[model samples]
Target: MKILFFDTKTYDKESFNKQLEHYPEIEIEYLKADLAPRTAPLAKGYDAVCGFVSSDVGSETMDALREAGIKLILMRCAGYNNVDLEKAEEYGIKVMRVPGYSPEAVAEHAMALALTANRRIHKAYVKVRENDFSLSGLMGFNFYEKTAGIVGTGKIGAAMAKICRGFGMKVIAYDVHRNPELDFAEYVSLDELLSRSDLISLHCPLMDSTYHLINRDTIAKMKDGVILVNTSRGGLVKTADLIEGIRARKFFGVGLDVYEEETNNVFEDRSDEILEHSTTARLLSFPNVMITSHQGFFTQEALAAISGTTLDNAVAFQKGIQNGNEVSA
Candidate 1:
């Protein structure tokens, strides 16, 4: 079967090409343009379209794809907040995603962010490069015996909790459905977790209830100078509120792998151009804030799992076999 891939980069091509050897029957065409209404017609003859987190798979795009005879929407990443699930259902387009592609990869990245931000390693590296080795601004606290609040308790969050435990930090988690397997973390109320945690890491999905979960009022609930890390969906935190919080010196440091308006700039290199997004520009002005392009799941193990599962999901759809990866509105 033929499939069209959207917003593909060099790494995506490399990983998918390597995994394509295992599935000789499938042929994939890569496109740099993201999947939006204007580009949906490009999949006219393909049986499926593969998209990344940045792709716009709204109702209009889904309608265009349906008219173009596209039957499947295969998401290479875990998050599907960008896709209009109800519209895909109406258009008879089956949606599937790689839900748990190397949870350890993302969990480890979250820890790395927290560690880097807490110890101010980025600043130290810059200072050392210039032969200014004074440790005056590099003062940092020990992770041992600190309270770590985890906002989600899925596979990724559970893995993060384990890492925090290894550092001798007390881990607490807040989730609608608690994972009994996360014995290292104690489940608590959202308010309790926010008010008590010294380090707060977000690992939740973006949904209506979770949109801007860390807003102005929620930030007010957090401990003063709390270290915050987000390796999850960008919409989970309101960028404006975060900016205000930073101005108030409410956070010790912030590490972000995703942002609410990252789709326009994340994968592309626009260093020569001026940044149009005011919030992102303001965020970059802060020395304590560290932002990375959405790359939490960019490891080799994660890419292999994503490509393998995405191909398996496509094969299942072609054979009319239902599996756990299938998503509906």
Candidate 2:
């Protein structure tokens, strides 16, 4: 079977090639452009089309893929929020994704952001670089005796829970679907999680129900001077609510690896241009805010594993095997 891989990056090509070595019979075609309305026709003559998180796989793209005779939409990443799974199902295209590639990679990054924000490490490092060893405005408290609430108990949340435990923190979690493995964590209600946790980390996927899961009401319910960390989908937290919370000092420190309106903004060239988006600019104005461009899954190990697993799932689906990760919408 032939597979057309869209939005091919340097790392994607390297990792995909290494993984495809296990399936020599499958033919691969690489396309560097994102899967959009115009680029969807490029999947012609291929049985399947594979893409990443940034690619648009909505109704228009799905129709174009159907026209191109592509039967499968394979995502090399865990989050399928960018893909219109309902449209894919309408087009009779099966969707597959690589879930749980490296939860530790993302969980560890979330912890790094939390620590950096809470401890004011960014400010101190810059000061030290200028030969100024002053310690004002860098007073950070100990993580010990702190209460940490993880919003999702998936693989990443479980990993973060263990890390918080290692810091001598009491960990509580809230998830619609509970994991049997995370027995140490008490599965509390969302309100209880908000009111008690000193540090709250988000690791849930973005869906209709989960969109803006952390909003004004939730922020109002949270502990005062709380630390917020997000390494999950951008839409999970409402940007306006976050800004209001920060402005009121309800959030002591905000660490974000993703933003609500990050598309066409994050991981792109903007050094020579004036900054757009007043919310983002205002976010940067705060001393306790730390923002990263959605890079929690950028680790070498995670990328490699994601490519391999996605390719394997796609190949298995084509060979009439049941892929556990296949989604029907």
Candidate 3:
């Protein structure tokens, strides 16, 4: 099977190439070009086209994919919000993804971001490096005995709950289906999670019900001076409302690995360029706000797992075997 890999990054090439040696039936040609309507035609004569979270496989792209004779769409990442699944079905293309590469990797990053934000470690690191060791603004409370609210209780959220428990924190979670394994986490309503938690971390998927889940009304329901961290989908929190909340001092510290306005900016360097129109730029101006370029799943273990699972998904498709990774509209 010949696969056209779009938006190929240095790390992706390294990891996938290493895994490719084990799969003699699979042939992948890496390209820096992203998957879009214009670029969809580039997949001609290929059995499948692989893309990441940044790839746009909308209606026009799906039409072009059909014209190119591509039958399969492989998302190397977990999230498929960028893909039009209904259009994929309409065009008779099967879509598959690596659902859980390394839940521990993302869970660990969430805790790192939460700790960095709440303790003002980012500020202290900068000050200490410049020989300005005054602890005037570095005051922070301990996480011990604090109430931590985790939004989702999937593998990742369950890992987060375990970590919070390790920190001697009281864990409360809000999810449609509670994991019985996370017995340490007290199942609660969303409103109660907001009002009760001292630190809140989002780990839920982005859907119609979950989109903009943390807007003005939700923020108003949260405890004052709550430390919030989101390592999941960016659309879950409304950016404008978050900005307003920050201005009103609603959050003690905010750590984000994802944001809605990060579409054009994620995994790219714009260091010398001006970002006058970017909400991310506005977010960077806040002292308590810390943002990373959606890299919560950047660990070596995650990369290898993603490479293996993606190839396994391809193999499943090639052999007419239905894998759990197959997603539908």
CA lDDT of each prediction against the hidden true structure = 0.92, 0.88, 0.94
State the lDDT of candidate 3 residue by residue for 1-329, as single tens digits: 99999988999999999999999999999998899999999999999999998889999999999999999999999999889999899889999999999999999999999998888899999999999989977888899999999999998999999999999999999999989999788999999999999999999999999999999999999999999999999999999999999999999999999999888887888998988788998998998988999999999999999999999999999999998999999
lDDT preference between candidates 1 and 2, better one: 1
* Per-model TM-score on C-alpha atoms: 0.98, 0.96, 0.99
Off by over 4 Å in 3: none
2 against 3, candidate with superior TM-score: 3
- Model 3 lDDT, residue 34, Cα: 90
lDDT tens readout by residue for model 2, 1-329: 88888878777788889888888878788987888989999888888888877888888898899899988888988888888888888888899998889999999999999999999998899899999999998987788989999999899999999999989999999999998987778899999999999999998888888999999999999999899999998888989989999989898899999887677665566778776655677888899999988889889999888977887887788788986888877
Candidate 1 wrongly placed segments (more than 4 Å): none
Q: Rank the candidates by lDDT, best first.
A: 3, 1, 2
| Candidate number of the best lDDT | 3
Q: List residue ranges in candidate 2 displaced over 4 A.
A: none
**Lowest-scoring 10 consecutive residues by lDDT in candidate 2?**
260-269
TM-score of 2: 0.96
Model 3 TM-score, 2 decimals: 0.99
